[model samples]
Target chain A: MRRRSVVVVGAGPAGLAAADTALAAGADVTLVDSAERPGGQYHRMLPDAYGARAPEAVQHGYRSFERRVRRVLDHPRCSWWAGAEVWALERRDPGGAAPAAPAPSCPPPKVHVLAPAPGGGPRRRHVLEPDALVLATGAHDRVLPFPGWDLPGVCTAGAAQALAKGERVVVGDRVVVAGTGPFLLPVAVSLLEAGSTVVEVVEAGARARVARGWLGRPWELGAQAGKAGELLALTGVLARHRVPYRFGRAVVAARGDGRVEEVVTAAVRADWSVVPGTERAAAVDVVCVGHGFTPRLELPVAAGCALRPGPRGTSEVYVDVDDDQATSSPGVYACGEITGVAGAPAARTEGALAGWLAAGGAPRAGAVRALRRRRDQGRAFARRLAHAHPVGAAWPGWLRPDTVVCRCEETDYATVCAAAQDPTATEARAAKLATRAGLGPCQGRVCGPTIAELRHRHGTGQPPAGPTDPGSHHRPLAQPIRLGELARPPAPPAPDRPDLAHLPPEESGS
Target chain B: MSPRLVPARDDSVRRTDHPLTVTVDGEPVPGIAGQTLAGVLLAAGRTAWRTAGSGAPRGVFCGIGVCFDCLVTVNGERDVRACTRRAHDGDAVTTQSRRSGDPGDARAGERP
Candidate 1:
């Protein structure tokens, strides 16, 4: 029998684990990632050109991660497509020129890829139709809007860390790292390692609330000993560096002439509403703010996967998946942060399970059971995380009327408020059209969740489409493709993969 | 903000000293081979390369490819993400802006 072909989009921990297990299960796998290296942002690898003697210095669990990378990438059945971006996924209609007899319950979507050509040449597009697809597209930093956030020297904490870890470059001489969650500790450490003087680390969640969230389930914390130890080490480094960690505080505004010269931090209540007369300004060259993470949902949503509200009361949404990590759309599986904001361990377990099942591994396998239990623990951790570091419903109160809400369009808070108040702009789409908030080049990746929550809280515009609707995340084109590239025909499939030849002639570009 | 490269001794991770240069806005900015355009620009004490529609200066907001805030024109290709695009020697990069009269301006650059 021909091997079950699996195409895993995203070479992060989840995607890499998926590819590794699928190949181990005797399936042909194609692993693709937009980055030049296999590690997604989690293990963001320094460029091979860097030729670092001690590459593990900036990374965690490097030895294990390196072993996994070699196991998957060196496997003969696995094809690694580095620096390749999946521009779109076209759902294959069952009736349209598909193979007859034993039709797949869920035919995998046709993957449209703009494969990077060697030596910086123009990219050549290739189309693939795999038997199964796994999306581990992961997430990005979701920064809530604030006054002067549009300033040049302000950036998300992830951005600061990426530069520090990937490029060994500091964002500025003096920096303030402010956000919610334990992720802030690592970001601060990365900046410090890269030679930045971190003046302070501000967390929005009050210490009492965060303690309650974590301490409520004491026994469950044992499962996350590794994560806790990591955080403890990070805090130790911060202490050594003499960086102040402040709780119940957030950067409410940034101010500067041309770039950020100072950040205004304010104490906040449990719900993140700023306390009056608690504002304090600190002189700093850069301010890094990240409320939490927003999942990269374009691919999953495009694949027609159903979404559910993340955690409980938060406005975040995640791909809905079953015990086997199978999404609503058959032949499609989702893992990693796209499913929920569980860290790398959970993502890896979920990916392993999804990969095994997608490769036609038996459901009752011993390994499958272990993966399920671990994934469940990860979900519990995710719930505790959400409870501890919830994005305050009152964060919108931090926004001034003139604050730029959409960085791309320069749509301000006042404009969005007016649009919500206008009866003519009833639906979310209408408000978007009127205010031009999420219609910019980013297509609302950065500001979609913020806008949705804002409208929902205002209680004036059209109610959210559904309980799980994360408005404005849906975009036909997942990544930017030049018109010239779109107009051109795709290159013929590579001869090594017989599966591509099975695609209909029209789709194979034969 | 003076963004500088971490000295090799101080940096936790050691890096190869491969040198490269990219001309940004008619000025040659020196950088390492593996460094991105944004890395080079930030190291050169330059921020706010692009401008918003209101002519507000902008640079490196997300430092990832998602935000598109670090966009710059590379070798006549428009809207290349400076944060993600590796800086190559001799690459001519012109900062982009949404302000009127900028080269990216549709009406200003359109050919009849």
Candidate 2:
């Protein structure tokens, strides 16, 4: 095996495993994370808490992941940088694309990172130079607006779970977890396990089946069904506690004063539209809602990597290495939710394949045929989970005109639509007069789709949809650098461009 | 219960109590104090915002300002991100299909 140095950003599932695989394959590895330890958002750890609080299936997976994280941390050849946040990344040669072949052994691509000490004082900046880069910056929950969505008690399901898991704090005793997709079940179970009263799981998907849902021809369906049964059994604890699980329903409004006091539930149609007569109101203290997750591609996009739309509504990076996992960006590889939300077990297998490929250990030539079959079987199985529940078109019915849609600026649907149409011509000259979207702190992550959908209703073309151009980000400061930070200089402007500089290094040699 | 879509003119703010008026898509409509343009329009029963290129029904999704689904030209400015801005009296609103070019049209906070 050949030896090389690689940098893996994010200490999550893919990041830690990639480093371990690279090190085992004889490459020196540097692992960096914005947190004090590994275990990204999904396997969040409590500050004063101990062990995993999830059910047996998740705990078993967590143990394996934790074991790997520990092993990688202990590796002699591995360098770990905790509490490091990467602000940007620019090519050494600047512009264009990642190199097709390895460069002459001079200095590898440098990674600039910002690390704030644990006790909390001044933040320190550090750089890591490596031959290859692996980005696994995980994902965040997708929040849709509702009447009381902005209320103090209303947070994304992920945020609520994080608070409960990481801080040993619960949002409220009575919580209604609403929305669609497999994530809801796990989040609901987690909340229930934490002793919260889960009044109802308002899923947009119906309980009735369209057809006899088959596992598939090859027959791993039995195992998946078993897993689903186990999760159902755990969630059943809600019933024993007399908690209600309302299928084919969604939360239309969450009404309260400073916090959530009541939630209105509506029966949904096939397209996930709210039925006229099925609206029902129930009192509740806390409401956790999320549609799904958009795979985070900020780091990858910042690096100028190409992305394509995934089966899920979000965009994902395009990888050339078949099912084994390798990205089109040379030497760079990724897996897990970073590529797509394929769950833990699928991620484990994909990560293993990526590690093997990254180390120059190609599988047997003929094995491709069999590998393809296995991958197909697994992907087919994964699809069942993917389509189990989806945030439907009717989700917007919950939003009252005054409900704040964009959290950054507190813009609501009324203001946004007014600006889009320019009724009085006051906002007539706003940028991109046509679509009238893409305005806000997040650019358009929260409201772009809604804008496009509305446009469609008005007989306008679809909103120009695609991943936001990540490469357009140009910032002088990497992090929230204070005035004092600028005063100190680690070194007087070296000839080389700083790590993550959008410009190519000034000093380059053939 | 389905989420309640509050009427623009609530019982507390009936026309007899305090009648208000606002312009939507160039037409004058009855409005109420403290009501948003969206609430006013929904109460008036106008479904379309900006026409999709193919002309489809697009409305609010992710009600929070994040979705950007309710964008329109409230005044002369072309690309006003609707979700973030508030509607004022006499404000002009027009349907938008797509950005028409000038990166810096107006709406300083609006991103191209």
Candidate 3:
């Protein structure tokens, strides 16, 4: 009998748990991550990543995740791939585009992986045929524009956390962790434990208000508050470790000689503009700022899975997966942050449920479905957290004229702003001409929303949301593929001007 | 329990003695020795990295290299994520600007 295989993307908590479930159920499992290590960013393990006195919460989280990862790795039926990025997916079809398989039915899917081996020479591609596919692809931080934000020392709350947690190095003796949502809390706690004197936590939302709302939603309040309490207790750090918590305040400007030394912050009004007299300046060595996170949806988007507006402004795949963690796309399932940023426990539950359902085993009648409902409930809470902490419109106040917007292309706000102000340009052409925002390797996946928001403010008017039809934006090769791989044999010769010609050369050939 | 993840209790992590001069928004500044461009800028107390609307300040948030928040221009390259790239002696780092119109078309032919 042919061995059944399941591929789980992302080695974070959810993916690992799913792989474990599959392995226990006697299914062959493969777990993959872009990093050299498992645990994703949240459970990142550093080689001397953090100090010996690192917060117990972080230590505990990683300890638990590590044990689970090890358990999965030790399983005879389970295989693991670190530093492997899944670049594309191929199904046997004419368009080569994998049709969105209908929900809950596990299809034998093929995943294309790019691994630039440890020595770092050329990256190689490998394909895996899995009877079931699970996306635990996790998320990236939300980008907010602020003046001097283009300068050095300015980073995301997640980045700061990583340095403190994984590298065990503090950004500076004096640091500020500023952003919205629960994401910033761990960062603050980590920095404090790392011996960095947290100058302040410049939060855009009023914590009091969020706390009030969170309390009303007892479940959410408990989940987040518990996490926060754990981190604070483990770090043995106090609120003073974080400078006074300035709620509803946004960083307006961060200026220094060549680095960040001082930051200007202000309270944001309803119109998303800074309120006068609320502006204040704080002297600091590093400023870590972010709004929130957008789900990493490249695979799903490329898979042609229909998307609905996520809790945040991002898009998420629509699935009928009846609590069993299945996607409307048959044979494919999603859990964890990919299902929306519902945190770790929910992701683990969803993954286990999916594994159980995928393995010839039904979810003990209503039990499996009930677990799925619990996952959904957790997701709903996550959505609210995302909503409340959504990168508020007022974050733009932090951008300076010289601040960089697009790092991949080196495009900045001034150039992008000029293009948005161009009265005659169409939205499509304007984005291309100005700022070089969408022109980067990412193709504007990270900066698209921010660009659109900037354009609207600059009178570009609102461009319609939803996938751009008739536009060559969407095509088969979504992730970065090797140039040589694309030009391989049997892949057609050059078509000078094709509908999907706009795709990057690396992505186009595939 | 991985040894690589433990931080040395000593704060005396000696940085290489290499100085670089970079400008942030026309202000000539000195970068610290043996630090990433992002670190030098942060040590110097500059926080904003890029702006999206009305030229605001944005900075590094996810330092582990996942979030693309800490992006900036190093020399002539656009989108040179500040957090990952190391700063060198005499390196010129500048804050990015929000471009208008076709963002890529302006520098389309330029080498990355």
Best by DockQ: 1
Sorting all predicted structures by DockQ, with the top scorer first, yields: 1, 3, 2
Model 1, range A1-510, lDDT digits (tens) per residue? Answer: 888999999999899999999998889898989988999999998888788889999999999999999999989888888888998988775543323332348687889988776565778678888999999999999999999999989999999998888888888989999989888999999888777889999999988877676566677865565776677788899999899999999999999998899999999998889999999999999999998899999988777777898887688889999988988776999999999887888889889998989998899888788888888988888888898899888888889999999998899998988887788888988888888899877899999988877777664755657866645778888999988788767765443555545443334432
Stretches of candidate 3 above 4 Å error? A48-58, A91-109, A116-121, A219-236, A240-242, A312-322, A365-370, A394-403, A410-430, A433-435, A456-463, A467-481, A484-510, B1-7, B10-62, B66-112
Error of 1 at A289 (Å): 0.6
For candidate 2 chain A, which ten residues in a row score worst on lDDT? A491-500
On DockQ, the stronger of 1 and 3 is 1
The window of 10 residues in a row where model 3 chain A has the poorest summed lDDT is A491-500
Say what the RMSD of model 1 is. 3.0
lDDT of 3 by residue, A1-510 (tens): 665778888887788778888887778777878776777777766432222333344454656676787799888776677666787766533344544343334354467777653454445566666677887777777757677665666767777776665444566667777767667767787777667778777777776666654455565543355543554463345455534766787787888876677988888854357888988888887788867775666675554444455654433323224456766556677777766765667677777777666654556757666766666667766766666565555556656677767665557788777877776665655557655676765566556657666766675555634532212234356565646754543211112213212223443434
- Model 3: DockQ score: 0.18
Tens digits of per-residue lDDT for model 2, B35-109:
344434533544336433223333333322323445667666554444223345677777665333433222334
- What are the DockQ scores of the candidates, in order? 0.78, 0.03, 0.18
Query: For all candidates listed, what's the TM-score of chain B alone?
Result: 0.88, 0.61, 0.66
- The best-first sequence of candidates by lDDT reads 1, 3, 2
What does the lDDT read for residue A214 in candidate 2?
26
| Tens digit of per-residue lDDT, candidate 2, span A400-482 | 66766554345666665555455433222242243333433355555444444443333223243334333212222333344
